[model samples]
Target chain A: MLAKPGLLVLGLALGLSTLLPSEAEAHRRWLLPSSTVLAGESDLVTVDAAASNGLFLFDHRPMALDSLVITGPDGAPVDPTILGAGAYRSMFDVPLRAQGTYRIALVSDGVMGSYELNGERHRFRGSGDALPAGATNISSSRSNSRTETFVTLGAPTDTALQPTGSGLEMIPVTHPNDIVAGEPAVMCFLLDGQPAADLEVEFVAGGTRYRDEPGIVMLRTDAEGRVTLQPSEAGMYYLEVSSSQDAANGQPGRRASYTAVLEFLPL
Target chain B: MRVSIAFAFAATGLAAAPSAAQEMAISVEIPRLKVAEYHRPYVAVWIEDAAGKSVRTLDVWYDVDLKPEDGAKWLPDMRTWWRRAGRSMTMPANGVTAPTKAPGTHSRTYRQGSRPLANLPAGSYNLQVEAAREVGGRELVTVPFQWPPKALTSASARGKSELGAVRLTTKR
Candidate 1:
């Protein structure tokens, strides 16, 4: 019953998400919490987020948060103010007042692209125009990234740690807020509440500013839709799962893309 | 206040538990694949508590059938279980660890009040199965189940590439 509050806020937040402006295709957004595991109730936690076109490089502009929903230990919404912003990232801090898990969800609007197929530029977007002889094709619209992270203070509880029931979702088998370094963290990906099988998940070591493309460990879920990753060190870890499907109508090359980013630390 | 309240609810749920004289079985299948290079997947199956601590290891299928038995060297590739319990275990571990399984359904059944089900307290647990191949992909699947069946507890999950369907059935 406690998960209802977070789910309620999430439902409202997702309903509002559709009206926002779409971001660029290459811009992958991520939310990074300052401390994944807080020691006590009075402790404060900060989160820095950005949309990056380059891999693991925070060089792109920070995304405007149309709806920033922070569900706290009791499943009530916790609002956070934008403390600062740079060209590539924005920062916010919140005081931890409860003893359970905290969930930060950022849902942006879907992006639409209509490019004229000049040569070999045929991609997902198409405008239902008749294809000329040896002409380039068009692409339709694509969904923006939905980013989320879990932060725990003092103890772990079943707050918003489960799947959010829409788009790209990560349901933790072993609770994400209570993970330990060197221990295997298990989770499953669900696309619209159903098990997403053979989904490719990219796990990257975090905390690097922007020098090199971080080493990526590629993993695919089993038939039952699960992937396991053991955190090597105690720093930041990024788990990204994304999928794209061709338009069911099978015409102007419409494609729907879904991405979910989860940032946490192994304690 | 919230933590204690939640803990009390969990304890009360466990206290109203059923007897543990039921039969349980785990069915794990390794899917056959066609690739340029194929090797038998080294699988590790274990149970963990809600806190993610390994409670018992059901089976570890490595290179037991090989001549040199050097297959144990690659068990670390099943990184999740190796970090949790495999490192503490000795090689040629009898009764629990076996050889690489072929591409088929393998069922492991423990009788009532066995070493695993007997020691498991009435609580929430996750049965995790991980498989890693030499040149292929690595996959893990978890089946969440509650001990002392809330009602004939049965859960199943499917993997895509390396593993088939994983099912855990408990009969009261």
Candidate 2:
């Protein structure tokens, strides 16, 4: 009984360290699409993505090109043509032809941000990318970004919107493409094909350009792993959901976070 | 464990089941918009919980009283309510359904618990009013109110184009 209390206390202390505000402020890599949904086949979609300490504040630090992975509505890989890259922002375009949800994910390579511990050099990574064999002496971290948005041509089909067992994905019980602004849309989330309950899924009102703390509404899934949300705005509704787990392989002080952004259009 | 689970389910069922005295009174306003192609907007009034689940629908105003009584065809234009509750309902829902109202405040009270509100559980809810018009913009306004209030509680919200000031009040 005494050992259990000690273990619980230690567990909580470790949890608090991971939730420190500074680390969260440091790694905010998001992909902001011009429109999550395209009205037709001829519609073109543009995205502005970067890795910065601020949200939507372009500081010219573009994400590593190799880290990006784009999937079309049919689950086939689609490549986005890079339009321009400046010091603080990178722009890309995906000519949406298929009429289904497209998912863009970024698994960045480790960025070295080192610190000292106990009079010795200690490196702890934020993202879960494993360090190279000889680079264990340096603390390394990588940020993983996963976002899902749809492009509809004629009529939407279920094939592309279905869950592909991505890290953290939401399968809209109501059709994702057919969401109306005022109606409640139910979505079931899966973390590797199993129901994930009690996760805090935040729904932010879209069209608030450059406002960091514009009101955020949060919903938690019930025991059945479902959340119902009414989109308040008529623009691109961005849902930011993330979860973190301790690193495997007996790595004592490593945490790996999996973050997902679902960009929905409520008309 | 089995008994507790069964009891929990039973409790939920009871809380959601409408009792004898519960009542809901809604007041909807239609603002006369001055436009060239002016048409009465099709309005839908419904109640949804914080989770966005439709608990009950109070009223839906469409072109129900058209020349050939063909206004039911355009009921689908009120997309949100049409998808949730409109499709299942038979046209001209007797005492509950009505034609589009003129620019004025209209009040309706469900004396006996209606189909949707009959099984409403006590929780935070939003009174959603959606209006879509022909040749005009669509507007939606939601007013948040609590159920089973200690006393009468009311809330109001305003809409921009197709909708007017929406006021919702509930009495236990």
Candidate 3:
């Protein structure tokens, strides 16, 4: 759940960080896979990473791939091939050498705050150690975010879907690759390995540029931190959640955000 | 007297198989569509109870001869059947899985005491046939009927796109 008071403080702190432009909040980030499920002795799937105002259009700047992580079914990191970043999107190809699921994610963590140096206020966005020396009145908050998507080679497996217990994450109750339109899919949110209750989630289907309405669905997680999504149509959809936690016991305020790109097949 | 009659019948070596008492026949029609690329559609035929739970999967027509046996990859294209029963069972199931059929009407029959219908309880059930084609659309047709038929019964349904006329008949 989002702490209201913490959000106000975090909002002010975020405003002080000139490094994070307003476009960062308006733009949506996603990872789109060429295919979620595959079969054969060996199959390859291409992926696109981008951030855009129009859902999945890739009209805005390319999402950074510096923190990209690809975990194979065997719980080992797999290197992606044909990795390249263009003006609008970053691209990569992953070979499904083993049969099971693969998780592709981009994880980033940083701090945003302001400090006073010789009576002048300065803003920064990076690790706390990166702050200037002899700084005073340091007000900072930690931010962690993850963007992810899943692909399966043969049979869908759950090993790759396990949460790392580091930041905000989603564990799919319904196999991500098996989602179908008109059927309900359950997903549970966890914050640092615990259920994140009462958090608001935004669900938006792709093809926003053509539709008359954006068709955004607002959902809230239950006490158990689960949300059941029933998409009426088949297409690529994006889910996003962001929340702020108040500072407690001398700890700095914290913000966590999660985003995922999911594809729903027609029934 | 009844014992004597039974003895006489046994002496004559006259006996009927239990399965001969009841039978079910189904006909599925895959329509020919004029399109740029045409491939035989993967089809699934099964029975479901009133609660929509699958009772039996009678037939599954897919590409069983693909190299490396990767043909099952597209099984999910038949989304309805895949979700209901296909995913639960292994592919190439004996007597149930078959090669995809070309555009035409195909028929099959199942006896009451056979592999699939042997233990089906007497109740209201639906005969569902679904077809999904690559680079094409999908269609499903259903026919409702009762098991352990009171008398000769027949029903048929038509599909608009991928499938044509589907008929089901039962006898007891």
Candidate 4:
């Protein structure tokens, strides 16, 4: 009977962590960094100042790229070429050195920001395309030198299944954590209601800039599409989910979209 | 029918929740509900719980047929409401199936018993509303609300210009 009690305690512990997953993640925010894109090794990437301001979607209002900086992998400054009226672009040729992961951080000294990228270091989904539920932007005070951005890449979330198969799934949603400290909470995205594997996803946070660098967090989803993190702090958190891998290509954009649910608890 | 049914979605951060709590209840209404945006104002209301943190978009009254696909877009605003109720249910039968609300009094009730409030046992919560108009601005008002079946039976807050007075009452 005593052994059973201990077993019960062990079972309770297991249920708590798995059921709640990670206690509410603190709010995460980052400023969009101006990183230079390399040509060749054509894997598309999308950059945004923040995910929450909704300006990243351009539905709120078009962001002025002129108010931003640009960089390239060759460690040189790059110019913003007018793609459409307000849209701008610079091609990336230098590939991420190896299969190893790197991150593209967005940096801006002013205002809060949120952003995300998918790769091995922070893979949150199951395929090359990720339906990221949320992202985080970090604040930074860097140089104003106009040049090509030098960014390390995070492990991108890879989309493994064709939505045409068992079909695209719905992302999870939760409440808003009004009290926590972070602005952009990394909302977790799970396919089939669990952490998935090997998918490309993106993250967007408050309008703060990461200066084209990935911050301290590098979370990866398990086979169930879940990203559980043990935070060093406690606060409000939100995640935005997007499945559109081609968002970097400016195509239909990321698919399987869901807003991150708010999580508030102690670290 | 390609008419535009304009609406708004917004949130309010009412209060902070305690560390170990369980569940939240949401009730919503609008004294300004009506048919047209310029007229009185059709309103949408809902509950957003923990399991489904997105607005459990409980109720909405606007011209669903205004456009073939108008009502679908506004679903994202009630972040908490959408996840619990809106995301899973079909639009026609969900809380927001109605076409518009009258201008008198309207109210709805919800509970977060048994289930984790969006996976959290208990904590603080906020009530948010977005009031949008055709030629007017959309206003989102939030008031803080707490949890754990407290001694407080009723709470109230004033809505933005688009809405009249707002009040909440709990029952046994």
Candidate 5:
């Protein structure tokens, strides 16, 4: 069983967030893998699904894995194991398998709790990780359409890094070419995509959240979605994105949320 | 490898320091005296477009004399700037300690000095101000200002006693 890593996010944020927040949740549902894990170096593909909560709703419960459904390259359902908690696992260590996309979805009818998402949904992944001979491209996050944010996948040869205008966010790949070895750095955010306006973006890097860095650091997007960040020290970094303004009307809880890509690119 | 890593950090940090040479400032004042029974304004100042769209976040000043629990409870009211820039940040004050200004004069300064603010494009934006006094009231006052990062004269606007006359000065 592959270990599910992000089950603790919501719990950790309880202290500062507003309970019974008036605003509906506008969160990135499933943080997809920006690109398929390289067959040469990586093997297993694990996923964690999160349910949405509308504004002012305070329902924080783990999604029970009552039925885990995964469709392989053949439009056939694959079996996954419920690891006792709010997590699920599947192994892709098969031989030179098929070259197609797979989807891993769940149906829990999510307990009738407090908050609801921007709409009705049970988490779904239209594509799974890739096999060496082929590839499976899935966005690292869903573009919470209600909030107008989009998610994109990355490729080894990606060149949109010079901060291309992609809608409400400008994705700047902060890691340079060769993928920064242990620190591959292509990040996603829900900004205006264009760089003409100074945006307030937040994320964690080298285990450190970059909400307030001194002065500022400039990351220029190259032809590819690749930008380089020479960390002042060798450490883990996470770039968390959120709204830079208050959702005016009735929505109360969420201030903002952006796409965060956890790439272990070592210098 | 470690030495190589050290050199890279040193290089980027040095590079991160933008060439310093521009500045921006604000001087907030209320014209007359309006003595409310007892309450100071929780003020938030930022820049936006004529269409009432927000552009740059300037500052948010709340009660520094609030208890830890009380502060946390009421802090979310500074919604505009918080959403655009504050949520991801941890406030330095555990309790409200900064002195609360009366219905008189107020001012603060911010400088890009020369580190060109990344997202502010060349155009027009409104220098806006909003205030919410505890057990008091809420009012939004705005003053428009143009941009290009060059030295500019003071921009001004006025309102009820809550927010008297607000002025902004920018030097690039």
Candidate 6:
């Protein structure tokens, strides 16, 4: 039963890509926190969210915080305050009252497609059932994407790192807050609660505006859906993994992508 | 029999301990930069083993005078020290936390058989000093030295911005 929906979503993603070529190539969405690790009494972390062509730069449109999720160390949802969306990016603050890690993510699941009506092709984004009534050559796809980062107040904990078993997710084999340069860190990717094997993961160091090359390190997941990353330098990094399944059994093609902003410190 | 044997070994170990006190003196220089907005940089000084595990945190210089909660908000700006040891420690650590200093040279001394260095094992260690400035840049300088110094040893490194010259001297 679980495999059935996976096949259907893959089909839908393929169909949607063919209908709307521009949407096939998605912009990079990210949530960059001011500090990934903190220690103090009553600390607050500010985060910036955006979908941009430049890594960590806010040249593109703002990422909406409507679907933003903040899971505190106790496995309970925490509300973010001082929320505001500007022209280029959205921002918010999460206070660290607890003594453990916090998971901050912007999760969105939507169906996007296009159809031909009276020989005019019209693009549609939203629910599958919201399509026009009398459209022909209808094609649609379902997309599930998550952009997230982690912040820890004191000692890091795993309660907030647990996977939701929905969409595409990454479970850190090495604690995200504990990543260090020159040491290999492992990350496991899961597609809808199962190991996502053979997926290509892109790791790019931040500060792209000053560099001529993007310096992207392309790595593939192992049979266990894990990737070992050894960052040479210590700084902020952006990681992205995406997968698309071909249309199967007349179902819409499905696409799922995950991105995270990680900070690696020098040993 | 076991208790008597353990006590005998402990007594012998204490008797074999070095009579002269060993100490390390660290000098950190925060360089003055010509910039529009110049805020004093937050600095962290510590010692690490060859494998990069933090052995001791000598000092942390941040906005310690600000409201308790407000100052620590920027502690992570000193990213290297924050990740290595700061994240695991409570803020305003007694005798270790101090206010950020103006652009100049500062010196501190840590003696063996003290709070932080009391339990340190003999090994090759790196004295790391990291400085981070708001609306500016960040830099780190490292000076390596060996414990139970064979002689009066001294080493230093220079940073272009945020930090100046960082020197470490060990005395037996």
Best by TM-score: 3
Interface RMSD of each: 15.8, 10.2, 3.1, 14.8, 19.2, 2.1
Worst 10 residues of 3 chain A by lDDT: A16-25
What DockQ does each candidate score versus the true complex, computed on alpha carbons? 0.02, 0.02, 0.27, 0.01, 0.01, 0.43
Cα lDDT of model 4 by residue, B40-136, tens digit: 3445554334432543354555556655435544442333333234445555554346766655556654533311222233445555555545555
lDDT digits (tens) for residues A1-267 of candidate 4: 122354345436544321110111212222233322121122233443322233123222222244333333333334443333233222223234321112222221211112354522231212223335544332211111111112323212112111112112323221122212323333334443444464443332322242354323445444556443333344322343333232333232223333322223331
Candidate 5 wrong stretches, greater than 4 Å: A1-267, B1-19, B30-36, B49-55, B82-89, B92-99, B113-121, B149-151
Candidate 3, A8-110: lDDT as tens digits: 4555666643223121454678899998866545678999998787888978767767778999999999899858889999899998898788999988777
lDDT: the better of candidates 2 and 6:
6
Question: Model 2, range B4-25, lDDT digits (tens) per residue?
Answer: 6335545655433444345667
Error of 1 at B168 (Å): 45
For model 1, residues A183-238, the per-residue Cα lDDT tens digits are 78888878767888998888777656644756678999887779997867755666
Model 1, position A187: C-alpha lDDT score: 88
TM-score of decoy 6? 0.73
In terms of lDDT, the poorest run of 10 residues in model 4 chain A is: A140-149
Poorest 10 consecutive residues by lDDT, candidate 6 chain B? B12-21
> Would you list the clashing residue pairs of candidate 3?
none
Per-residue accuracy of model 6 over A1-267 as CA lDDT, tens digit each: 122454345446556422121133356778999988787776789999887778879886677787889999999999999589899998999988998999999886777777898889876676657666788877777778888999998779999999998878999999999998999999999999899999999999998898999889999999889999898898889999988976667688788889999998776
**What lDDT tens digits, residue by residue, belong to model 5 across residues B71-121?**
433443444444333333344332212445766777776544212143355
TM-score of chain A of each: 0.72, 0.66, 0.88, 0.26, 0.35, 0.85
C-alpha lDDT of all candidate models, in order: 0.67, 0.61, 0.83, 0.35, 0.41, 0.83
Comparing candidate 2 with candidate 4, which one achieves the higher DockQ?
Answer: 2
